[model samples]
Structure formats: C-alpha cells, structure tokens
Target: MTRIGLSPLAWLDDVEVQRRAAGLRRSLRTRPPVGAELDLASNDYLGLAQHPRVLDGGVAALRTWGAGSTGSRLVTGNTELHEVFEQELAAFVGAASALVFSSGYTANLGAVVALSGPGSLLVSDALTHASLVDACRLSRARVVVTPHADASAVEAALAGRAEERAVVVTDSVFSADGTLAPLRALHDACRRQGALLIVDEAHGLGVRGTGGRGLLHEVGLAGAPDVVMTTTLSKALGSQGGVVLGPTAVRDHLIDAARPFIFDTGLAPAAVGAARAALQVLIDEPWRAQRVLDHAATLAALCDVAEVPASAVVSVILGEPEVALAAAAACAQRGVRVGCFRPPTVPAGTSRLRLTARASLSDEEMALARDVLTDVLAAR
Candidate 1:
C-alpha cells in the first residue's frame, strides 16, 4: 500500500475538531413548531408567511402546475405565473421592468456579474451581504470596499477612479443591524460619477416605503434611470425567488445575458403564486408594514430601557461567543426561540443573540419576549 501526501487535509480536519471542542461548532435544528409561541427570529417581517391567501395560492399552483417548474425559464419552465408576477412586481415597485430568478443568491450573482465587467469597478459597502460579495468575486471586476453605510466613503472611492465604469451596491437595510443605508446620497454620488447604483431591498420590501414599495421608493430613487433594485420573495413576500427590477433594456439584456436566470431552473409555481398573493395582501393592507416597524421600534425601546443596545434586529449583545450561545439556549429553554450569531456570521468580537421582529406578534407576546430576553441577558 502506498501512503498518500494528505498531511494538509489532516491538519484541516484537526482545526475543525478543535473548533468543535471550543464551543464553536455549528449544527442545524429540525423543524420547529408553528403553534402559539413568540417568534422573534424569522424574516417574515409582515407576517404574510402563514397568511391564508398566500397558503391557498401556493396550494393551487402546486396542483395546477405540478410540483416543479419543469425546466429553466429559457427552456420549458417559463410559465404564465412567472410573467404575471414579474409584471406586477415591476409595477408595484415602480421599476421600468423586472426579471425573476430562482433565488436571491442567484439573482445577485447574475446581475452583479452581468452589469459590471472587466473594465468596471464595483464599489460595495463593506457590510454588504455575502451574496453581493460572491457576485463581485464572480464578476472579476476591480472591486473596492467602502466603509459600511458611509456615502462619503463611497464618494471618495468613486472620485479616485472617475474614468472607469463603476457600479455602487449596498443593501437597503443591513440585515444584521437593520440599519437603513443613505440611499439618496449613494444614488446621487453614483449618478454624478456616471455609475449605476444597485440596491438590494431584501429586507426593505414589505417593511418600508409607501405600501412597502421598498427603501429606494422611500428615498425617491425609484424609477431613476441610474438605479437598479433586487429583492427576495422569501423574506417579506413569504415566498421563494428573487427579482431584478430596472430598465426594460436591462431586463432584455438579462433575458439574453444573465446566466443564472437562463441556465438555472425556474422558480417553483407554488412560490410564484404565493408571491403574487402576498403582494396582493400588501396592496390591500398597507398598514401592515407600518405595524411591523412600530413593533420593531417598541422592541428596540424595550431593549434600550433595559440598558441594552437597541438593535434593528433587536439583538442582545454578548461579548463572548459562548455567552451568546448560552443566552439563546436559555431563551429556547423558556419556550422562546431566537437566533445566535457568532464568529463568521458576526464580526470577531461581537457575537450576539439576533431577534427579528414581525407584525404578527401581539403586544402581550412582545412583552413576554422582552421579559424572557431580559432574564436571559441578565443571566449572561
């Protein structure tokens, strides 16, 4: 028998084993209950995930179109539901046109790569989502990371390279902190620099703007020639898929050029139907968005009164990774489940218990969540 040169692989496994021993290992949980529990850990900002109409639409689409979209959109999977959702979403968000993809991850990948090329410079916020980072990597563009949410930093970066084609990208709402970006400043800077601005409204839609039109519309940047927006239906819309809304020419270009949209499988019919229904619910219940924001503000106030930093995600900051994990476990033990963000998910020294707010939670439920969370933080 010949011994192979696998020492590097052995060292890698050894590091993983050490990480597990240090109370830093990661694992997945099985399906949680859907009953009468306070949920402050989900992204269903408007509480449409379990809406009756959304559920019914999903069921109807499943039965009518079968389980899956048979092929890629460019193949046999392009269906009427996709077209309808695209049109409705574009009109609702005030975009010139829209193109849907299988997932937000793919949409970001396709759009970022397609729009910016070798000669292009991609200036992105340092705290932008991982999807955008992946897209920049795949684009092979000259990438520059600006300070998070600092439009002045973005302006400085663009000023240094005014001659190169550029695209400015950032999340409308920072997912971790729930901080809103300076969209108007960023848009204005990009426009002046002759660069395109791409805002990922994954957290903003159904939670901001008039009728949840999103942060861009809230900042009066919607329908601008230099702005493009991408969103996920799985978040606020309580469905699964992603869309890029921009000019008609951009959509046409994506139809021919976006590899993820053309080469990947189309979104399931159920998701399309559920998204459409969710949008209708948003149209009918515009106040739901405000209610969610109100709930968030209330929770933030509760945290602040308790002397904790008021997180947009309503997180309880724990200085150490184990302390954060222990705090979350304590909450779960007391009949409340929350998210624990440690290294990799969080920065090196800022592990925390992330609590997402939703409109569905009653006042009593929010109070209980606060009571339980306060106890957990004190114990930590």
Candidate 2:
C-alpha cells in the first residue's frame, strides 16, 4: 500500500488534535483482578460479580463446556445452560420466551432491526444507549427521535405516524445519569398508538423492582404481548452476554430474521452459568436490591443532590468535560474511583461524574467515598 501526496487516513491526526483540544480524548487504564481502590465506578450494583457462588458457577460451566461456544447457536453453540437460563430468565421477568445473544450490543442491534423495518416507524428516545441508536440507524425505518423522557412527544410522534407498524424504544434505567424513563406514560402512549414497546433493562435487572424482576414487572407490563425487553448480563447480573425477552412469536422471529442472532456466536457457557447463579442470588437475597438503592440515596445525599435517582446510579453533573476530568482525578487521588463521563459518552455541557452504588460496599468504603466526594466536589 503506497501513499500518495498524503496518507488516506491523515485526517485522523486532525481528528485526534480536535478531540484532545475539546477534552474528548479517552484512554484505557488497566485494572487489577482485585484492586484496593474504593470503587464507586463499576456497574456491579449488587456486587454479585465477586460472590463466591457466582464464581463457582462460572468455574463449573467453564470446566464442563470448555472455553468457547464453538460456533453460532444455529450450528453448535446452543448448550444446555443457554436453554435453562433463558427459560429461568423469562420466568423471572414474566416473559413468554427469552433469547440469548453474544453481548448486549448485539442483542440491542438484533432486537431493534428485527422488530422494525423499512415500512415501520420507530420512535426512539433522544438519550437511548449508543447500541440502540446504531440499531435504529441500521433498522432502515423512518426514525423519529423524541425529546429525552418526553412521553407527550413520543405519543405525538406515534399517534401521527403514517406507518401502521411502529416501535417505541427506551432505556429502563438510562446509563448516563441513572434517570428512569417515564415507562407508564410511554407504555400508555404505545398502547394508544398501537405500537410495540421495547425497553432496555440493562441497568434495571439487578437494581430495580421487587427482587430485581425489573421495571417491566414492577409496572405490571411484564407479560404484555406488545411489550418487549432487552437486558445485559454484564452490568448488574455480573456476567456477560445479553437477552431479548418477549412473546414467543417475537423470539421465533428474532431467531429466524435477526442478523446478529443468526450470524453471531452464541453466549459463552460461563456467562450463562454466572448470570444464572447471580440471578438466583438476587432471588434468595432480595435485600441486595434495596441495599443498592439505599446506597444510591446515600451517595446522592452526600453529594448534596436534592432528590435521589430511580436506579442504583447517581449522577453528579459538573460543567465542562475538563472540569469533570479534574474532579474525577481528585476523587481518585483521595482513594475513590468514579465514572468520569465526557462527550460523546454524555451530551456536551452535560459531562458529569457518574457514581455507582454497590450493595457490598463496606461502611469503611462508604465513609472513604463520602469524605472524598465531599472534599473533591467542593472544589469543582
């Protein structure tokens, strides 16, 4: 590959410079298997990722199933664990059927595109996850982006749409600020408009509703034929992979038509095992969910926030991305680790420090976090 006057990719340098100037550049930091830092950053809300039972389950599955799933689920990857987990998860969430995917990203991609097509209309929230955004882009449907958490706007779009088939998409617990979608109003709107509702419960599975049955179950819409749900095993479930739960017909359609599900490799056996075990832990120790919420409330109060968030995440907004970065560094220096979100992880001018509340956070860890945040956020 010979270059001409300038390399074809030379614009990347300019892009990097622009990103650095705008404080949009991101770098990865390697974390140890076990760290001493007081962690308020990760999404392990119930701290089940480190639980002995979960680990043992993963180990057992690893030993029994080897490492990889071999191939796509159509060919060889669908194992006994996948079937059992899917059945259990569907039953837990009150869905008729469930289908597993390689990752939450692929799951979202598969669900959105499979459910909505060229002739369909998709009313998506402004602040949905990037996966869903990309899914909409690939869906080929005429997408109408509604204002963030505006059920009225969503209803308006759905009500006035010319397409008979419409799908409304949103996150149950938004990953950015940990705010919740107006699910009841949205569901009502969808029902009124005769549209299907797809709720991403990625952050809600191990944190929200009774025993973490999820927001759908909390609001009595879990088994509704028009309602579909997607979630991740990585976050609260403390594992890996993703799932789509809904009517058995929808599950059958995804199996046959969703590109991600048809082509992508199946979920690993270890993740299936871990998610199953963590889910059981949640069922047995329902207090874990409430503990996470209580921790979130405490974090909000310590940060001097006026109201607590709906999920196990609390957002502390600082102005510029640079300012947020500095604040995060200060907190880390004081032995507290937090999520420093900048564009495009968050919208411009809304760059914030996202804190996670883990059920297993010790009193000492909580004290350390409280003082560190009080001292650090004071400066910003």
Candidate 3:
C-alpha cells in the first residue's frame, strides 16, 4: 500500500487535546429505553415525550404519512397535518399565523434573516440563545448586543440605530440562567422606537405564563403587530421541529424569502402529529405547567441556589468546568442525571449543573432529587 500524506484536518487532534486539558470536552451517552436514573438533564418539561397519547399520535402519523416529509414545504411536503398543526399552534399561542420549521435553530435563522438585512439594525440580548446569535450573523444587519435582560439597553440601541427598520431580539426565559427577560418593558421600548421585537420562547412555552400559552401571551404581547415569536416542539412539546409565529404577512414573506424555510425539508408527519397532541394536552392539563415550576422551586431550594428559576431550568453555578463536571458525576453516581455546562455554553468561571424539572416527576423522584442535590452540594 502507498504511504498516505498527512491529512489536512490533523490540527483537530491538537484542538481536542486542548479541549480535554481545559475540561471542556463533551461526549454523548445513549440512554436506556427504561432507565432507573432520575432524569434532570432533559428538556422534557411537560413530560409528554413518553405519554401514551403523544406516542399514539406519532405512531398513527407514521402509519399514514410514512417517515419523511418527502420534500420541501413548497413542494409535495406540505401535508394537511402540517396545515392543521400550524393553524392549531397559531390559535393556541394567540398568533396571527405560524410557520413550522425543521428545528428551532432553523426557525430562528429563517425569522431573523428574513426580517432583517443589510441597512437594518438588530438589537440582541447578550445572553440570547446561540441559534439567535447565528441568525444575527447571517442577517448581515448592524448588530448590537445589549446586556442580558436589560430593557434600557435595548431601548437605547433601538433609539440610536441609524437604520429605520430594526428588530429587538431576546429570549423570554434565558436557557442557561433561567432568568426572564422584561417582556413588557422591552415591548414598550420597541413600540416607542418603531422596532419589531423578536422573542424566542423556547424555554417559556409549556413552562411559563397562563396555561403555557407563552410569556408573551401572559404579558398581552402575543399577536401584537410589532412582536414575533419562535419556539420549539422538541422542548416542552416533547416532539421535534420549530415554529415562527407572527403576523400573516410575515408568514407569507418567510414563505417567499426565508432560505431555510424554502430550502429545508418540512417537518415530518410524526413530529407534527405528536406536537399537535402535546399542545392539546397542554390545553387540557394546565396544571402540568405549574407542577414543573413547583418542582423547579423545590430543586432550587434543596440545591440552596440563590436565584429562583423562572421556568423549568435551575442552574447551580460551581465556578469551574472541572468542578461542575465532578458535581454532575456525583449526582449520576446517586442515580440522578444532570447536565454539566461549561465555557462556550456558558461564560468561563461560571460553569454549572443545569437541572430541568419535569411535570411527570413523581413524589418519590422529587424526594430523591432533593436528597441527591443536597448531598452533592454539601460535598463541594
């Protein structure tokens, strides 16, 4: 055999070594179908991922529509299931319309890029999700990143922007810290500056607001002319895909202009059906949202964390990547699974364990969580 030359990607080995040295390496673990571990790491806030009705919805859709969407939504991929899901989702969230995407990331990309372009200004929160950050990059808009949840900063940016067209972007509930953005204040600011507010409700939907209609709806901003919202079905809905909710004109415009929406294949039938089922569950069982919040409060109290979470996310800052990793491992040893977040996911020196509360967690599971978290934190 002929000797092969050194590969061009050989430098990636050094990068991996650096990551390991910095304690920032990440790996995936395949979870068992039925595990003994108490799940605190997953985003299944409402716990509908394993619900019988939700599963049945997916199964029925799979039998009827096959596994794939078949093509882009502009083509043969636009099914009756998609239209029905969209209509139901829009009505449930009090939006004028909704456009579904393959994932939350792509939905953010499509909404941000399509709404703002060269000569427009995008005022994004500093702690906004990475999806929105990437969308801002792709937008080619003059981007101004303000301090986290600071409405004044957003207002100032919007007021000072040279461009007449502006969009103020923020997360309704920040994913890492679980703190809420001042939605009312931000909306008022946007209104004064004639700017549109784009809120990513990924963490807020099915966890916050009245019956999980979302934070915007709770604040009376849903269906507002100047507001746009994007959310995920994979999180609270316990399914897969994303939706951009706003005015009818915005939906039509995205249909025509958004590259991600135009080029990407539509969401599969199973996800659409499952998400619709989950939405209905949320509607019928409003208490599920409250249960998750109560659970999060209980976990936070047991963890002795200073800040109370506004949603299902409860973060316990450990100040170092290695320490957070060790803490998570300690919890795992006690049959509790928690997420360890480090730099890039979170800022350096603020690495932490991210725990998500589930509505379906039993009393025994809650007790176990409290005990495990208390023991782990005490050991530190």
Candidate 4:
C-alpha cells in the first residue's frame, strides 16, 4: 500500500472550487441579431455598425476580395484598399503617416516594442488597458508603473531613468472607469525628458475631440515628432482593425522590426473598406461625437452617478462580483443590456455595471434606458 500524488490535471478542480467560492465565475450569452433589448453594453459608440454605408462598404470589399487576407501584410496581403485607408486615417488624425494592424492589441504591441527595448525605460500608467500592460512586459525595457493618470509620476520615472531612451504609454480614456488622461501634461513631461509618448485613443476616437479626430489631434499633439497614437477601428470606425499614427520613420521601423506586424496577416479588405467609409461618415457627421458624450451624461444622471463620464463608458460600482452580476441580470430581464465587469477585468471589490452610450439611440430608447436603469439602480 502506498500514497499516490494527485493527478496532474486534477488541480483544476480545486481551482474551480476556489473560483466559485470567490464568486468569480463567468460565462457568455448569445443575442439575436435583431433583439428587443436596449443595448448599452456594446462598444459601437457611434452606432455605425448597422449604418447602410458601413455595411455597403464591407459588402463591397467582400465581393471583390473575399473574406480573409491571403497572407501576411509584408508578403501578399498589402492591397490598394489598405494603403488608401491608411492615408485617409493619417489625414483625419493629422499624423505624418499611419500603419494598420489586425487589432488594437497588436497595434499597441507593435508600437511599444518597436519604440523600446533593453536600455530604454518604459513608463506605463497603472490603469491602462490590459493590452498596454502586456505590451510593456514584452518590451524588454526597464519598466516602471506610475500612479493612474498622474503625469508627474510619469515625469519622475522618465527624468530619473538612467537609460537614454524612454517611452510613456497611457490610455486617452481609461477603459474600465472611463477616466480621461492628462494628455497635455503627459506630453510636456515626455518633451522635457526627450522621451517618446504613446497614447492609446481606443476610447477617445469617434467619441472625443472635435469631429472625432481623437484626443491626440484635439490636444495638438497628433503629428509631434516625439508622439504616437494607437486606436481601434472596431470601437469607433465600425470595422475590425487597429492603427498606429505618427512620424513616417516610426511606421517604417515597425514594418521592419515589430514582430507582431511583420509576422501577422494584414487586416482584411472588408475591414479596411468599412473603416474608410466609416471615417468619411465621421467626417460628415462630427456631431455624432458630441451626441455620444451627451448620451453618457444622460446615463450618468439616470444612474445617479455624480460625474459625467469622460468617454462613452460609465461605471456603476456595485461592490462584490455577485452583486454586479445580479444587477446586470436585473437590467437584462427588464429589456435592457449593460456590461458587467468583475475581477480580472476590474480590481477586487470594485465590480461594476459598465454602460456604454450610443449616438444612434433614439429619444424613446433613451427614455426606456432611463426608466430601466433608474429602477434597477434604485433596487440595488
């Protein structure tokens, strides 16, 4: 008779037990393409996903190019559509040049790692999106995490760094809480330290700045030699892609050096076309940006949140993960859809209902949302 060790894979059962006990389990649910639910959970802030022109743009590309990009961008996937869209994006954002990636996550990885490495210092905002946090870890630079949205902390990190090269990365609008960053102050600190600044405008594009040109353009730092910006087409442009905008040299460098860009497939033709059409729409309908902001304010008031959201996101912290989950269920049961964020997505004890405002929501829709949210929150 002998004692045997637990099976190698059996530990997962213990982990599951711990997760359930901590109330951290998560699962996904499907929704009909056309649903009765009032959606404030999606990232389609401008509500362009169903816009006729946006659909037509994607469809036209599909008819011509098929579904997938045939190969990596460097080899066979480069198309006229991609080049044109890159140019359009650069002009729209007032950048000297632009390069597109398959996703915002890849775009952040490319820009951060290409701009930094060993002997360089990377200063990152603690509250940045997870994508950026992952990018910093992969950069192989002397990494320093500063207080959330504190430009002075960034300055100190950059100023005292022994490395000759430095890069500061932040989100223009924090994704979880929708807090705005001090872009101006951050840029000034980077300038003083002669460090490069990278701002991810994933939440700010098509929802901030005049004409949805993005927070970098809004702050007059769009084409600065020491500055770069990354954004997603999925969130604002109603398409699936990512972009890095800055000096032409940076684009060239990424094309040669960035592992994510060099090895990854180019963005699909349909996404490029949809993004281009969506950009034109944004140019024509600049008011959509302000309208979404207005809608966020309305949601804040309805939920009794004190401050109006800085971007389209509004977070209503409901304590433990289980509490937030129940509240989200309550909203869905009442014909409204909102996002529920728990641990890993957010910190412990700060689980929340993350609401996103859409520009295309009709007045009646807004009223419905107000009633549902008011009742749901009041119950909580």
Q: Mark the regions of model 3 whose C-alpha exceeds 4 Å error after superposition.
A: 1-4
lDDT of 3 by residue, 1-380 (tens): 65489787999999999999999999988899987799999999999999998999998898899899999999978899999999999999899999999999999999999999999999999999999999999999999999988899999998888898999999999999888999999999999999999999999999888999899999999899989999999999999999999999999999999999999999999999999899999999999999999999999999888777789999999999999999999999999999999999999999999999999999999989989999999998
TM-score of 1: 0.94
What digit string (tens of lDDT, one per residue) describes model 1 on residues 1-380?
Answer: 66587564677787888887766799886645575456778788888889999999999999989899999999889899899889999999999898999999898888889999788899999999999999999888899999888999898888898456899999998887777899999988987878899999999999889989998998898889888899999989989999999999889988898899989999999999999999999999998888887777777666563533222356666768888888888888887878888877678778887778787888788879879977777666
* C-alpha lDDT of residue 324 in model 1: 82
lDDT for 275 in candidate 4 is 90
Steric clash pairs (candidate 3) = none
Query: Lowest lDDT 10-mer window, candidate 4?
Result: 1-10
Report every candidate's CA lDDT: 0.86, 0.93, 0.94, 0.92
TM-score of each: 0.94, 0.98, 0.98, 0.97
User: Model 1 scores what on Cα lDDT?
Assistant: 0.86
Model 4 C-alpha lDDT per residue in residues 332-356, reported as the tens digit of each score: 9999999999988899999999999
Candidate numbers, best lDDT first, in rank order: 3, 2, 4, 1
Instruction: State the weakest 10-residue window (summed lDDT) of model 2.
Output: 1-10
Please report how far candidate 3 places residue 274 from its true position, in Å. 0.5
Q: lDDT value for candidate 3?
A: 0.94
Error of 1 at 44 (Å): 1.0
Lowest lDDT block of 10, candidate 3:
1-10
Model 4 lDDT at residue 331: 96
List model 2 lDDT by residue over 1-380, tens digit each.
Answer: 55768777999999999999999899997777997798899999899899999999999999999798999999999999999999999999999999999999999999999999999999999999999999999999999999999999999999898998999999999998888888999999999999999999999997888888999888888989999999999988899999999999999999999999999888889999999999899889999988999999999999987888789889998979999999998988877889999988888898899999999999998999888999898877
